[model samples]
Target: MKKPFNSKLFFFILATLFGVILSLPTFLQTQGPKIILGLDLQGGLNLLLGVKSEEAIKVRYATLASALNHYSIEEQILLDKLVVGEDNLSFELLDSNEKSKIDKYLSQQEGLEIVEKDLQYTLALSANEKINLENFAIEQAIGNIRNRLDQFGLSEPSVIKQGSDTILVQLPGIKTQEEEQRALDLISKGGHLQMMAVDEARNARVATMSEREAQSYGDVILPFINNPQQTILLKAIPILDGSMLTDARAAYDNNGQPIINFTLNSQGGKIFADFSGKNVGNRMAVVLDGKVYSAPVIRERIGGGSGQISGGFSVSEASDIAIALRSGALPAPIFLLEKRSVGPSLGADSIRASLIALISGAVLVILFMVFYYGIAGVIANLAMVVNILLVVAVMALFGATLTLPGMAGIILTVGMAVDANVIINERIREGFRAGENFIKSMENGYMNASRAIFDSNLTSLIAAVLLYVFGTGAIKGFAITMSIGIIASVITAIVGTHGIFRFLQNSIMKSGNYALWFGYKQQVYKRKL
Candidate 1:
């Protein structure tokens, strides 16, 4: 016969496990951990931009249009014929009949610099420049896509350019799907970003509407420069325009006021400088669509020729404005390509399936423990409950999103968590039958089990870590949940199970209740009568 194991140890282990588990939520959620949110769990928006080849071709022709216009070249007179083909632009000189007139006209265009080679007049457009313009437009489209996403107020959005003509946008955790889609749809429209005169009456500028009215507009669009007279409304055209801006930045003036600084490309610079020189002291408005972004008073001939638009802005706001300008406005109207919604019913189904899997797994394990080890199996079952409670608490504290894959990890941990306890309990029972005292048997059991426990767990942990490193999205979620659960299980098994047994040992000593606990007496083991 064997003395029953100590109840004091069991209670202590139970208390310690429960206490730690209960406190985990507090520890993890103290400052709100970086918990992952799924696209469905956090209803947000997704935008896929299909860049039309036609749009790019149209833009190319538009650039050619501007070039022709700049030289005062009559489209019909100088250009013999214009043929806008699908993938190429072809034009013949009107006076192929007059070689002298064509030569003289080509001489006046500064950068166009056409040269006659092998009897064919070829415009010397730099290959690099053409490539750069194409790349720049694509980049600008990317920028516009980003701005549109920002307007939706989604935190940590994923927006990137996919090819020369495609953009992919994923905004997780957005509040309204419709609003997010609406904002993104507006992006491909590429609303105009222009400089226009501020229409005082039409402008949403008033000294002091009621505080409520003021609040309604969320912060009135303030002027970049304090001037009432010159307000140009910068805007975007329905057709693709304004590829002229080469660079833009944020800086401070001589008085140290925040300002948006911009310079057009050489061709655009020529036009801007000329415009500034002619419109000196007039009000030039920077407009986007129909809204006034900045209205600056043209002080002097701005030929040298970069100009600044100063406004009352914090550093962040100014940087955003600068980025918006550099990125260029959106182009071509956009339509919603796709829309999706994940109802709560699906989420409920996920939760239900997860719970069923976990419970089914746990129940089978508990049944096996009881059938195999009898009384010791009961203790292990109780410990399993404690383990699960702790895992839940830790998850709540960490604010971890419980995805279906994460649920699988939790259930897997439940099975593995009790393996160490099973090893040690079986070892101790065998030691008792082999003529060892309680303390000796218990010490030997844990000491011998440590290596096997450690070896198995370390291997599991390594696998979990590797999964976490390589996996993305849902796979990563599983890895994280498994890793955390495994760690918690090891801790609870070693320290937690030890505490439970220790309390049991102490209780047996105090109450002389070993027989009741283990279902055997010391006398019954003797003399084999």
Candidate 2:
């Protein structure tokens, strides 16, 4: 007689225990499994952003112009007619014979193509360099948005590159309109911060003169946030920008007003310390997104790479500023191509409908199985229950998101799980009709049916893998649940049901009663030789 406690039974019991333990956290509402619901299931914000690649190119050119301006002054190179155009930089050489000298200087600069025409040189980014810059901008934008979202406390956000110059952002579980707006504003804001010395003389002149007149004097006018009528003219050169910031946090000032305190990196610290030490008592404009937040005069040489931006801001505003500052600036501005908000009520309806469909399908499958195979059917039903449990447990264990399609996959699995049992039962019935003993017929049923079951399930598993690799969000969810279900079905339908049959045969069922339990009649067949 076969032992009641065989290796297959032992494995089935061990797997069931492990799966139950893994699934316990989900049932008990504890902090074990970190499974997150998808955006469709939880209701959240979805934003599609288009990166302004052209603007990125322009910004790169402007930065290069700044570098050239600095080099010209430091190296005593007379670069005349320096024009920072929209798409390229153009400059005239001081001497036509000095073309070789300028070429040597420019050869050291990377990502640039220099062209000479009639003693005038134009510099633009190479084609490959432009593509690389655009790609980098998109990548950096994703990273910046992710950092901001992390600080904003939204969990399990999906921020990925959708296309060449577009990004897809999904913030799960955000239901409120205020929250939606806040998240959108937080992400869309460019957050370009710069510290430039306030040009008081130019400011006074700009008040009396035209806007173009101030530009002629190498000044840029930015309006104050608190008082838009009041504007400050800042030097064209900035002392430091947000890229130098290492950390930022929200804090309360002496008067209990919210403020953002920031720390700069080592290089920024040295530059800021030097600039502040030499320009004590001079006002410096704190500009963010082209708007002046504050203009404070330096009281002393501010060292330690630390400073504060204090304005009449609310606590939430201060927090937003801190998050933006800490996350650094986006490489270029983003345009909101599409915006969508999913309400919790809609998600709730989806969940209810999905649950109904799943339960209805499972119940129907269970009833059909019980009606067709009788005692064997009951055993299959038990295995099906275990199969579902193992599927959920695996999903929870892997922290995979559950979606509406995933529910459909589970429903489909119920039918597939029963199919394996049906194959085995039919094979066993065939063996019985051929006048085989109960033990020999049952063993033959499992062994003969195993090949077909393995082949079918193996093909399904391969399809699931391919779907997961190439499919999008919801499709990937379906593939994941389907893969887990297929694996669980194989274990339950074969090992789980076979172990139960072994136990029944070894411990409960008598050899003579096998035909009655198996729901088949033993028939002697004559073979013609």
Candidate 3:
């Protein structure tokens, strides 16, 4: 005769499975699985950008100012006021003299039609023009941020413009996190490089060259400022600049020193080759954000078009520089105003809190189960452990990022998953009270509970799906995890619990241990009317 299955023994095996599956993330993460880290888990910078609509309007008005100057009709024109209506920008230009000619010239510009009456000429944009301008500025801003983040070597950073002007950047995992903000600042600077004549004789006079001579001999490159002193000659006119670079990596030079290797696209290659060939023996500067990073004297033409920039750099620094250069520069400067790092102390607190919550909740559930149905509750609790194991295995399989909210979802799911088994077990207890045999009652309980279990979990699964569809990062994470748990609960409750129960039933029948399988020692409490 087969011996009845021990509930304690079942729980031990289930626990082992749970432990193995839960450990998968740690093992995979240790092996560098490239899992996405949240901002809280990995320290990084957060930048809040406020788009200057007035500033954009000022630039547009400045263009008008320039156009007025170009036409040689300058009468100390003052943009008396810029009234920003809901649809367009209305500028009140007040200039007593040359007002008629200036108004005529401005009206000639297609989108910038003007209304000239007396001394005040109201210059306003059409509805479509205003919308187009706003869209173009926003697109430019977004592209700039994208380029900056790319240069900073942030992998898959999130850059979304919230309203008309606010940009939300969420970079989950970034090395040297400070570099993120620094790169943003540099890109915004809009620096450039320039070429200048070198005051030096041939090789014979090299030893006598002054500091100023050496600096000029290389290239008089300077940062691009609102008012710059000089303009350096570009090696290439950037036929296709940062937009064309497919990939960039850092490697060692022949001397085993750090260098950045970059590859340009087909069009970029041709432009680079043509420029390099034409500019042999001339010095060209590699400018980024208006600053000259390196100025190499061209010896020969490079046409096949892949090149390396070798500066005296450490390995880590070389890699970082290469990453930043490859990613396009930012359009506007961004400052890191706020930073908060997640310390190990906070992580420890979270872990302890989670443990306490899990233990307390599990104890309550176990007590409720035991008091309600005695031995049957113990079996269901054993199944709950397996449910958790299945959830973890699924998590490992999908590789979902787990947040604190997701952990809460997991803990909450533990109780909910067991509720399914509890319902089925209680139904079996009722069948036993109705004078059915152990095996018959078990089958009846499962069959009756199957519909309720499926319907209940299915409804929750739908809600989870909807939440995932509409929710943002963290909430979506919670919904996804809860959904997985619900699905796992259904399978473990219906299949796992039934399988264990059936296995125990068969053993009890063979070994004459019916009381052990059915919890016949427990009595049902009747309600007093």
Give the alpha-carbon lDDT of every model.
Answer: 0.58, 0.82, 0.59
**Order of models, best lDDT first:** 2, 3, 1
Model 1 lDDT-worst window of ten: 232-241
Candidate 2 runs further than 4 Å off: 21-35, 65-83, 90-105, 115-122, 160-166, 427-448, 508-512, 515-529
Residues 489-525 of candidate 1 have per-residue lDDT tens digits of 6666766676666656655445533334333334221
In the range 484-506, model 3's lDDT, one tens digit per residue, is: 88977776677767767665666
lDDT of 2 at 505: 71
TM-scores of the candidates in the order shown: 0.52, 0.84, 0.65
Q: In model 2, which residue pairs have backbone atoms overlapping below 3 Å?
A: none
What is the lDDT, from 0 to 100, of the residue 24 in candidate 2? 77
Poorest lDDT segment (10 consecutive residues) of candidate 3: 191-200
Report how far off residue 268 is in candidate 3 (Å).
Answer: 0.9
Mind sharing the TM-score for model 3? 0.65
- What are the per-residue Cα lDDT tens digits for candidate 2 across 100-160? 7678878998988889887789998899998898888899999999999988998668788
Q: Which order, best to worst by TM-score?
A: 2, 3, 1
lDDT of residue 453 for candidate 2? 98
